[model samples]
Target: MEWVLLVIAGLCSGIIGALVGLGGGVILVPVIVYLGSVGLLDGITPQTVVGLSVIMMIFTGLSSTIAYMKKKTVDFKSGWIFFAGSAPGTILGAFVNRGLDLPSFQLYFGIMMVFLSLLLLIRKHLKPVHWFVKNGRKTTFEDGTGTYVYGYPIWFALLLTFGIGFSSGLFGIGGGSMLVPAMLLLFLFPPHVAVGTSMFMVFLSALVNSVTHISLGNVPWLYTIPVIPAAYIGAKIGAYLNHRLNSDSLVIVLQIVLLLLGVRSILDGIM
Candidate 1:
């Protein structure tokens, strides 16, 4: 039964993660923590939860990246550039995660979740920054929708992704909560390209972050046994759905879920 629940959670996480480029940790971490809190699972700590979540993200990112690559949506150059900053930040965040207790971790994670939810809620109304579009590197992408041009300053992108990576390593929520929106609202990236590129960066950053967690003995290998394959399969399904579905509705649904989860987590931390 416990394994079944874990598999279900992984599938949900992977689908949501791939659909929106959230890397699925946003869903998985809270589920694991909640299960542990209710005594359905054992030996759950902030470190271990984060560790397991990131490990699962490795598969989520890889599976989604492959699917996006087939559609030619991934911006490989930007992914690499973003990764340059994210790698070091991920290492640093893993170290910081070791210092947090469960209550503190929950509090911070809840706040982050709420912030990300609100960011997404407001993202559609926001416009791309003029300075970023005018002065930064420029590229064009063409699809059935039409031709779109977008770019970001290399230096700013590095700095932004570093913060995203730090958050990922700390919370195991994958940086896509922040990265995807930034690409859409601040950097002028097309929606599909933003999600695809974000997943690519997620894959690379998770690789670095997971290694750091493994070395710190934070990973619960047994817990990850069911999650990996489930997440991988779900990612493939999500990638397929991305092309067919109107993501605006999904984003609205996701916003509500995150907001509710964030409030619950915050209350849990306080109590």
Candidate 2:
């Protein structure tokens, strides 16, 4: 029955993560932590929870990325560029995770999420010039449906991705929460492309982190194995839903999740 519950959690996490590009770890970690706290999930430490969540993220990210590719929503060019920085950061973050305290981590995570949520809410009031590129090498990304043109400061994005990668590695959150928002708000990427591209980048970063976790024996295979199939199916469904939603709807969905999760994490940390 516990296994069944985990499978359901995995299914929900996959669907939400794929739709927002936040990855399953955001949802899964909290569930795993709660179950472990209540002794429903035995022998599961925080490290184990993070490791297993990241492992599941591998499947979630890969499944959704593939679906996004089929829809031609992925922006491979930008994805790889950011990946160049994210890859190394992921490896380094995995190594650093051992040193952090759980409460401190949660507190900081909550603060970051809240800050980001406020930014999204007030984005319209802020000058677009402050958020978007004023002048740069314009790039055109062609998808199956149409073409998107945008300009971004390449150096800034690469540097920012390094920080995102480190956080992903440390927390096993797949970096999508940060990555998708950065792409959409700072890089001015189309909504669909941001979601698809975020998934692709997450797959790469999570793959690296998974290897690191597995090498360290942080992953609990027994706990992780049962949830994989459900997660995969959920991701496919999520990708389909992502395409159906318009930009405004997407932002609202992402904003609500961030706010709720953010408050939860903050309260958990304090209590």
Candidate 3:
């Protein structure tokens, strides 16, 4: 039964991660913590939770990237550029994660969740930065709707993804929550391209993060058995749906869920 629940959690996280390019750690971390709180799981700590979440993200990112690749949605050049910044940031964040206790970790993670939810809420209302679009490296993408051109300054992108990667390593949330919004609002990336490229970056960052956590003995190998495969399958499903469905409604739902989870985490930390 416990394994079943873990599998379900992984599936849900993978689906949502691939669907929105958030890498599903947002969902998985809270669920794991909740289960631990309820005595359904044992030996839960901030580091272990984050470690497990990053490990699961490996499969989530890889599976989704493959699916998005088939659709020609991934921007590999930008993805590589983003990775250059994220890799070092992830290593730094993993080191930082070792210093956090449960309450502090919960508090900070809750704050992050709330911020990401709000970012998504206001993302559509945000406009692309004129400077980035005008002066940055330009690229074009075409979909059924039309042709879209978008770009960002290389220096700014590096700085931004470094922060994203740091957050991913610290919280195991895959950094997509921040990256997708930044891409869409500041860089003028098409929505599909933003998500696809975000996953690619997530994959690379997760690889760095997982390695660091593994070296630190943070991952609980037994707990990861069910999650990895389940998340992989779920990511495939989500990528398939991304091609056919309107994700605006799903984003709204995810925002609400994240908001609720954020509040719960904050209260848990406080009490």
The full ranking of all candidates by lDDT, starting with the best, is 1, 3, 2
Give lDDT tens digits, candidate 3, residues 1-271: 8899999999999999999899999999999989988999899999999999999999999999999999999999999999999999999999999999988888899999999899989988876787898999999898898999899889999999999999999999999999999998888898899999999999988999999999999999999999999999999999999988999999999999999999889988888
lDDT of each: 0.94, 0.80, 0.93
Over 4 Å off in model 2, which ranges? 123-137, 142-147, 247-257
- Please give the range of 10 consecutive residues that has the lowest summed lDDT in model 2: 127-136
How does model 2 fare in lDDT? Answer: 0.80
TM of each candidate vs. truth: 0.99, 0.88, 0.98
Candidate 3 residues lying further than 4 Å off, grouped into runs, are none
Cα deviation at 3, candidate 1, in Å, is: 0.3
Pairs clashing in candidate 3?
A: none
Q: Between prediction 2 and prediction 3, which has the larger TM-score?
A: 3
Q: For each of the candidates, give the backbone clash count.
A: 0, 0, 0
For candidate 3, give the lDDT of residue 132.
Answer: 90
The better-scoring model by TM-score among 1 and 2 is 1
Error of 2 at 219 (Å): 0.8
